[model samples]
Target: ITDWKLQKEGGAWNHCSSSVNHGYLRAVIIALYKKGFTGKDIAASKIASKSTIYRIIKNFKESGSIVVKKASGRPRKSSKRQDRLLKLIQLRDRGTTSTELAQEWQQAGVRASARTLRRRLLEDGLVSRRAAKKPLFSRKNIRDRLIFCKRYRDWTAEDWGKVIFSDESPFRLFGASGKKLVRRRQGGRYHQSCVMPTVKHPETIHVWGCFSTKGMGSLTILPKNTAMNKDGTNTSSESNFSQPSRNSLVTNNAFSSMMEHLAIRQN
Candidate 1:
């Protein structure tokens, strides 16, 4: 009919796919009725059932509007003030938990459920949780670090070039020594079973050396028998143990002896 073609062009029939837009069913029934189409014909057209079409026509004639009345249910717990309070909490204390926000709001005389606050915060574009990293040092630690910077400020280029930078780090032979699973919640107990049996492998050691502008020095592997005392002093046992065999060792020492042999050959 004329009305049916008009509605198809106006995109009114598209709303019928949604339960929330059931009001569009009324418009369809009204258009069919105005074109002198009977209930049987309307039902046969598959727009809606006979009873649904009748109800829509009756409601449309009574109310003059196509809006369906809201169904009765449990009312919203949060008021406008509570919504604004939720937004304020998010803006001021982002990444806070719903339970914490609920408790704080309760103390402020605006009692709301944690679930309600959480829903409101999400609706207001605020994420419910985040992982925050606490800084390792404080302002006092930063201020004290300036002492090292000041001590190195006046060094000449040659002095800076001669300075060595070295640090020690533990090397695990079997890879990482600790558990790898991460737990998100605080105080949550994690499974502590060892994934692999711990076994001692051949000990490995690394020594790195570097100078300031000239770049790194050659790496020297230390003997496994080498050990440092508790006070960082080298013990005599390690010194003697690191020495080469009698045949390889020279009285003049390898470094000076090699230099002398090279000089004698050049002469």
Candidate 2:
């Protein structure tokens, strides 16, 4: 304990990043070296390790200074132009996986590791993530959608406000179709935000609902195995709407399973 205190007071061994601190410690070690303190003796004092002390002395003898020289680290395998080419190749085919990108990069005369490729792409702000899913429309579907938009383009918000858009969406009774991520506070296990809400087997049913710009309408669950059509449950749903919204529109027309606007009326 007394020896350690003396060494610490003289110049303690500390983990330092700055060269100045290392240089000061090197000076202290050199001073001790001059006073005939052998490497084993300095190691015993625990001021610094025997290997570090020897290295510092060797450096001082060679450089004529207490400051240790810094060695250059491992060189980068890819050049700037090669990295830019890699980004271009990556952007050319976004769906290409890292493994596939490595192959492609190899074909272009650049042999880069998968980790190296990822690091380069990260530098370019291009990160790998799951591609979002979207419904692909046929030419006719596109034309129909465009026509529908054009037809309603002239209508004012008040004209559209009277409308109620209705649709039937089926939900899984057992569990969610896909996992949903929720941000939760600590110790909020029983809180509403942390709850994984799901309809139990009995309460689960196919619901038909109405939506409007003003507000929402009543929600009614359909009975099992009933084919919904314009003349069936959908027409009956008009009465179930609690709001005095006189207008009505049933998109995604049930008859054809196409986006067809129907029964849009203002009373």
Candidate 3:
């Protein structure tokens, strides 16, 4: 058997220069052999087996170079066209899914799997998919908005500010909070029982208020007993305070109360 010391020493010269020491292993073997080092001594260096060292020496005698043959493996799948197509898909359809883009590419004469498209898109610094935000309004909504703007063009800033804006909005105590893609399982209903805000008729009270830039006025929570007339008049059957139910009386009382409060604060 070859010794470890010779093999280790032989490997040092073998690893040094690939250009100058092109047949380095064979040169080491010959050099060591001439220097009174046996084949067992060369094998002991652990660089190569004794048989491998002999084979290298024989091969060098026949061929000029000690370079190993190139390896053979599966060729790369993507061509330049495929790479360009991936970049094009990434640039054009930023938030589109890989599956959707793959289908699109197939239609455009490039057949690729979703996995392939996903990998390529990732390599090209593009995400496979993303959440698409829901638009706040549509074309009809935009048209109605423009019409409202045009109609309110004559109103002054103070006039607009004096006009109190109030709208009813529903709030659920336990509602799902985000926009997410929901997938229905096998034999399962598409709808899940999530808390939805709802208002029962007669249970909900009507709230109205008026305000100006200077101050806010009293907010009125109208009871079900109060009747609203077609002429935009409030009529109550009974009065808690010593005030008349007539519209003029109510208006005058409210104006006097507001003015008196303002005067008292000003003093």
Candidate 4:
């Protein structure tokens, strides 16, 4: 007590550094008691509160140890097995929302709130994020794509040079590549729900063009009501060709110009 020091700041005593270790506190209390110091005197030394001093002395006397025993609290709502089941449910359908997952989990005998489910998923390293947007492909489309790939698999670049590649694409004015959120682990980018299927016909303007290995072609912007013919023929003058009398069957000015340009370039 005689060698004790306290820090002073702003003309006031700050007792922040006065906190001592539990074992050191117990030893100090015991030492003071053995030295015939009363509780008030021991507390006056500014070592600890009178309550803490008394509690430490009582603990040491009754339990022969100043260490506090552990106390049990509320248990977890979910068990390990239930946690694993929750992970499986999420993996089954990564696009399922928390509420939807909760409903599905009810069938599996686990009752938990959406918030709790999210917490459990986070613990298992599963994150809910916007799913990647991908073009919707039907079974027929997939089969056709496979066949096309197989058919062209052996074609060399020179062989492909003879073929003309043409397509019409609609450019959207206010289109957003929005995505859906899904729960998935790392390296699950290509998972079923993670790859969003899109089937949207957004408001756009159709632009037609064609290209070959030798040269490129002019782009023709079609009118709003222009319906492109499937048999390489223009349906009407609404297609806005440069000349409708140049050829009756093939009236696509862009396609004709592309052929003429490619022919000149080839010569």
Candidate 5:
């Protein structure tokens, strides 16, 4: 026997362990055969099953080694480097379709199917998902939003609690809201393509509502083509009610004024 010893715990070739490497089994069988051990004696040594030992011995006699040779067949469509390029394309534009990605990747010197491209992206931890819808803001709008956030950054919860926030929105009565698909990795919630952009005003019925930390305040449907006056009143023929109080912190086109005028006249 050789000086090589096997650890009894969690080691193969010791007390009939099942996790024996093919090379190790082949070496053991050859070693035992050279030592004048019969096939039956080698089987009893517990290195491998009789069938496995005989097959390995036969292969060794014919090929001189137990290493598996590469199979002869068609080559892969995309190499590892090409697969990485596909991933880069996906990261650059998550909204790109698999077919589109395949088309783009062809320019990079690789021809592959869309399914294959998707598989490569999946292997790299990219998944196809519906992009989240977000309100689109212009550069000026974004700057104003940042300024607003910073101005109120230090406000306490109590201070915010007293503030009433209001907004006007339109809901489509007869139209489908389209959705977009995107491929993204984990923790990419804020990616540009991963978010759906919403316009400032969509063509639909305009409704106004206001809420506070205390509770909901008012809900009103604004009339179509209604315009505000210098006193912040909706100057439509339907909105001819009592004039607004001068003490009201009004705007030429403020939301609270429209909501209040609608609410008072409805009662």
Candidate 6:
């Protein structure tokens, strides 16, 4: 009789006239009853009303636990295993719409509606979010970036200062369009699975610029669809910054050569 504890089983509460005691308070009530305290004594002890105490004792005697019986209702439509399977399917493709999910779930023998699917996902900590926009990277781009990092991982601050970084970027004359939705948990906004990859839009213009510890380099506008070589040659300008110098460390790219030249001249 000493083992009564708060039950973790999920169930609807039967409507009752009095607020039910739970946890330690319920434990104390049962303890007093086991100690031969009368229902009147338990009530007079200010624990619960006489009827409530008597009901508790009756329930405890008849049922091994004092947990209030749930009000009878229709059972859950899906089993725990089905719910888990639904979660797995949703995670397999975060972009799947709830309607699409419902169709897939029906194939798996769980005929839940889109609303029900959303409810189940919410219970499992998955919510729909507008996917974060990330620049699409090719395998070659990723490999080159990794190589670049490893090559310069040990470079000092001064070494970096002597290097000018430049890159060309496209800006859409209009604006970025549309959004995609993905299911994700909290704090996973930038997860690869939760991102929408994008490339340069068609109706856009490209601009190339360079900067270094010395100062900002000249801003140069390039023709639409102009190819930018790694050596920074095809889109060269008459500006002094674009002229390659012998002090170039990494590339003949205008920025590197100019920054290195400036560094040498200053020294």
Arrange candidates by lDDT, highest first: which order? 2, 6, 4, 5, 1, 3
Q: Superposing every Cα of model 6 onto the true structure, what RMSD results? A: 12.9
Q: What is the C-alpha lDDT of each candidate?
A: 0.56, 0.70, 0.54, 0.65, 0.63, 0.67
Clashing pairs for predicted structure model 6, backbone only: none
The candidate maximizing TM-score is 2
- Per-residue lDDT tens digits for candidate 6, residues 44-99, read 65544578778888888999686778888977768999999999999999999999
- In candidate 6, how many Å is residue 229 off? 3.5
* Alpha-carbon TM-score of each model against the true structure: 0.43, 0.60, 0.38, 0.56, 0.49, 0.51
lDDT of 2 by residue, 97-193 (tens): 8999899888877788999999999999999898977456688766776676677778898877766677777765666767778788889877887
Instruction: Choose the strongest candidate by lDDT.
Output: 2
Tens digits of per-residue lDDT for model 4, 128-190 = 898865445577655555555566568797666655555676665444455467889999989
Arrange candidates by TM-score, highest first: which order?
A: 2, 4, 6, 5, 1, 3
| Between candidates 2 and 4, the lDDT winner | 2
Off by over 4 Å in 4: 2-41, 44-46, 54-75, 103-112, 172-204, 232-267
Winner of 3 and 4 under TM-score: 4
Give the 10-residue window scoring lowest on summed lDDT in candidate 5: 236-245
- Cand. 4 Cα-lDDT: 0.65
What would the TM-score be for candidate 5 when compared with the true structure?
0.49
Sequence-dependent TM-score of model 1:
0.43
Cα lDDT of model 1 by residue, 1-267, tens digit = 455545655765665567634655566778777778777778776666678977777777788767778789987777778788778876797766778889888866777788778788778777655465533546654444454445555878766444333333345556566656654555445435424445666465544322234454344444553432222212222233333222322221222333334443466
Steric collisions counted per model: 0, 0, 9, 1, 0, 0
lDDT of 3 by residue, 169-191 (tens): 23233433444555666665544
